[model samples]
Each structure stands twice: as structure tokens, then as C-alpha cells.
Target: MKNILKTVIGIIIIVGIVAIFGLKNKESQDKKDISPNTSSSPSTLTVINNQIQVKNFEGSDFENITEKSIQVNQGSLVKTSSTGRGILESDNETTTIIDKNSEIRVAQSEQNKTKIELESGNLWSRVKKVFGQGEYYQIETNNAVATVRGTNFGTFFSDKQTIFMVSEGDVLAISINPETKKQIGPESTIGAGQKVIIKDGQDPIIEPLTESDKKLEWYVFNQTKTTPTATPRPSPTVSINPTPTEKPSPSPTSSPEPTPTPPEIISVIPKTINVTQGPVNFFVNGQKLKRVTGLFLNDILIKFFTIDEQTIGGTATSELQTGTYDVSVTLFTGEKLTLPEALVINNE
Candidate 1:
């Protein structure tokens, strides 16, 4: 009886040990599954001009980036200076242009999905066609979302409103309330040469692209890009001879696309700053300053005042660090003027 009892006790102890080892191995495998892994090459960010800043992820401080290309992972935040521009290229061959004074984040990036969150400013995206069952490319704002399969489009977000202008292909624009995080209206299908605006607490407004809209710098900039197919021209009409008594009908005439007018910066007063001083008022002398809506010293926005049609004043905050920075102004119509390396700030 004692021998039998010893065998049973030994068997129980062996089973317990086996169970403990199994649990530990399973836990180890789980940890391996959850650990971070580099699935693919990160997207590339190339600084086009001026200066930009990037933060790799949440809780990280922004680092200045200039005149170079760098790999950026998902969850990265990119902020451009007043006159800065950058280009982002994804593995799938989609390209996005980040305009000056813009902020964007790579919210999600995967083999078949890409999502960019635009906090403010402008973005021009040329997305590759997604033919897979679940593939998609999207840009989101506080009050709207623009989704495209393959298209060339531009987005502008300001003052709690989002505007989407499609140049080629189509875009799906959806309006949503930022507070409740719910759809405010039905989905809008924006076709080529059309624009849609989504405002807070309002339904999405759809309209065709206007001639003035085409005259904007953003529109003119994209005109140089190559399209998949040449736009078909309208067939010419045959003119019929009018009778002697009838007045000849006026012939229809087509107008050429207007070129965008670039802003001119003549000078910026108080070009040198003393950091020891609490704050200082600086003035910018230039053309077309009356429409100026915002002024930036590098990437920081300061208090702006329009003294006249050709002069703009800005008050620099004491928090400004010692550095040489660009001075730029933005018009209410989204036009911008940047004077690169225009201001020098010193600690002395």
C-alpha cells in the first residue's frame, strides 16, 4: 500500500511540473508575438525647402529637420515652417506634398492602408489606385474626412472648416462632428474639378471648382505634373454662313488659365532681436499686406497687425529662443510670402 501511494504522489508531482512549464512557454510565445517588429521600410520624408520639424511618436519632442531626407515611421508628426515645404513618399508609390505652415501625422501605414491626419494647413496628395478588396487611402481633419482609391486632390483646413478639391479622379468626402465623433451628413462624392467644404455642425457643401479656384497657387503648382492620360479637347464646331438679313452670331471664345501672382517681400524691420528683452514689435514692409491674416516667425505664429496695405506688424513673444528664422505672412485667401533667414535673434 505504501509503494502504491508513493507512485501516485510522484505522478501528481510530475504532472504539476509539466503544467507549470507549459504555462511559462505559452507566456513566452505570447510575449514574442506582441513585441515590436519591423514589418517593412518606413515612409520617406524629404524636405523640399526651408525648415520643418518632426516627432517620431507621441510624448516625443519635435526635432528640427532641414535639407535632407529621412525615414519616418507611423505615428510621426510633421510640422512645416511658414515658408517650408516637404514631400512624403510611401512604399506604395503615393506621394503627398506638405505645404508651409502645415501639420500632419501619419496615423496609420501598412501594406494596403494609409491614413494621414491633417491638423491644419494644406496637403496635396497623389494616391495610387487601390484595387485590393480592403485597400484604402484617407486624409482626415477635425470636421471632415477625404478618402480616395486613386486620385489627385488638395485639402485645406482652417478655422474649423475643411475643404477638398479634386483635380483628377474622385474623392469621398464625409462630414462629422468633432465633438460627438459622429457623421453630420451623408457621404459626398466629389468628382474631378469639383470641391466640397465641410464645416463644423453643418452639412457638407458641394460645388464645382471655380475659375478663381483654379488661379490659386496650389492649383497652378500641380498643373506641371504628368497625368495618366491627356485631357480630351472639345470638338470644334463648323460655322454656317448667315443670311444677309440675319446678324452673325457671336463666336464663343475660350480664355486661358490665369497665372498665380506670387507675393513680394521688400523688407522686414527690426531684423535683429535681443533675446534678453521681454518682447519686441517687428514690422514687415511688403506688397499686398492688407490681406495678411497671419504672420509667423519661423513656425511660431505671433500677434499680427496690419498697419497699412503694404505693412504688417508682429509682436515677438519672450519665449522665442535665440536663432535665425524665416519671416512669413499668410493671406486670408491662402497666399503666402516667406522671407527666408530674415530675422536674427541673439541672447546678448
Candidate 2:
């Protein structure tokens, strides 16, 4: 009888322990369900160059906002200057350059999300793309909406119109009527070097901007890292057909075989490379990555940009600093294209 009772007690204890664990799991899931809308951290803004002022719409407060930390989504600023530059830096490494002569209004800001209204002037932004995240960073204007991500781009509002252009990647520029809050059709997916113009009471125009027309300066990042590999070519389909009639045989001479052509490169990254420090693999994506030389950065000649065509990569010669730079490469045939930055220094 005692043995039977002991067995029954053991079973009851196991059941009790499982019941307690199930209740704890239920409580944990409840907290997770409430976290998204309720828990978001703050973001900040820093002044990089020149002077900038922020005017709070709440109770008509105003202050000259300069080189310091500023909060997001607090209040709106009604005015802007004719010339000044500032950077809105987030914790996620997303940087927004509040360009010179830009009149903007802040709507709301939180962790991994931001919304603003550019009433006039110009502003540039770069936001990293996070897959599977239900969030966006948007810049609005009286004439259009520029949603920024996966690219470096800028928006300009002046002369009764708004223009958004892509510098390194792609950006979505949509036209909206601010007065009616209605969208104007055939939304443009603006790619690198492309732009869209939104004017009042008209259809949006999407086209490539001229070199002289692109005025906003942008800082490009990770140009070498983002590349989608190409798909393999399909094999030629074999078809069965009736054998042709044989022709009369003639005395044949030895003929030379044609030389095979080299494979062509379609698209590649590391087009704008950054070597933080030490030896790193110089990655390239394309068929036969040969002849990747004649490179320049920030108008300075870079010998390290030279590559071993067979291996398609090389080691760096030295260290570098933190700053913006432009790169270019010259072809053997004298054609020139933008290239990667490189720095060379003696360890000794």
C-alpha cells in the first residue's frame, strides 16, 4: 500500500511542475505582445557644420540649435535658414543631413523610425535597410513623399516644386497632393542618378538629372559590400532533327581553332571600398575580375587600388581616417568611371 501511494505522489509532483512552467510561458508571451507600440527608445541630432536653429511649435518656443544633442518628435520647427548644414544621427547608424536652406517640420521620431515634413529647401538622408522590420523613415513635403532606405539620396523643395534623387542606391519618390491628401499616379521607383519632380496640380515626372542640376552633396557608404550575385546562364536546348544528306568529301587542310573570348563582368561592388584597418579581402562580383586598376579617391591617386587580375583582389598598403571621399578608375582604352578609396602608409 505504501509503495502504491509513493508512485501516485510522484506523478502528482510532475504534473504540478509542468503546470507552473506553462503559466510562466504564458506570462512571457503576454509581455512580448505589448512591447512594440509601447516600448521605443529615443534618437538624437548633431550639428556637423555651420549654424542651425530649432523653433518649437509648442507654446511658440524658439532656440538656436547647434553642436549638441537634440531630441526627436518633441515639437515642430517652422523656419529654416538660407545656408546651414546639420546631421540627424540615429542609434542605428542611419544618418540624415539637414542640408542648407531647408525648411522642415518634425512629425514623429522613435527607435528605428522617423517622419518629417520638408516644407521647403533641401535635405539628404541615408538609412540602412533592415529586412523583416515593419518600419520606415520618410521625408514629406508639400508636393511629394520621399521614403528613404537601401540608398543614399536627397530631397529639394524650392521654386514651387519638390525633387528627390538617388545618389548611390535607390529610393521611392511618390507624389501627393498636400491639400487633398491624395496620391498622384504612376509612382516612381527612382534608382541611382535618377530623380522625380512633383509639382502642384500635375502628374509626377521621373527622369535622369543632369550633372549641373544635382546640387545636393551626399555621403555614400558600403558601396563595395552590397551586391546580388548573377544567375547562371541557361544551357542551349538540344533538338532532334532528321540527318542532312551527306555532301561529297573533298581533301581537307588543317584549320586553326578560334581563340576563346574572355568572360565579361556584369555588375560588381567594392566599387566604393572602405578598408577600416589591417588586411581584408577585397571582394568583387563579376566574370573574370581582371583589369580593376587606375583608381582614385578624393582626387588623390591610389596605387593600392591596383589589383591582381587573376585573383581579383589585393592587400592594403596602410591606414585611413574617417571622412567622405570620391573614387574613380580609368580603363585601358581611356574610359573613366568612379572608383574605390585607398590609403597607403609605412608601418615603419
- Models 1 onward score TM values of 0.55, 0.50
CA lDDT, candidate 1, residue 299: 82
- Please list all clashing residue pairs in model 2, or write none if there are none: 224-270, 327-339, 328-339
Instruction: Give the clashing residue pairs of candidate 1, or none.
Output: none
State in Å the error of residue 183, model 2: 1.1
Residues 124-237, candidate 1: write the lDDT tens digits.
Answer: 898756646787888999999998988889999999999999998999989988987688879999999999989898999999999999988766554432323344455557
Q: Which ten residues in a row have the lowest lDDT in candidate 1?
A: 223-232
lDDT, candidate 1, at 181: 64
Model 2, which residues run further than 4 Å from truth? Answer: 1-41, 57-59, 78-80, 131-133, 214-348
lDDT of candidate 2 over 82-171, digit per residue (tens): 434555655555666676677676564556666677877777776666524767788888878877666677787887698887777777
Candidate 2 lDDT trough over 10 residues, lowest sum: 216-225
The regions of model 1 sitting more than 4 angstroms off are 1-41, 225-348
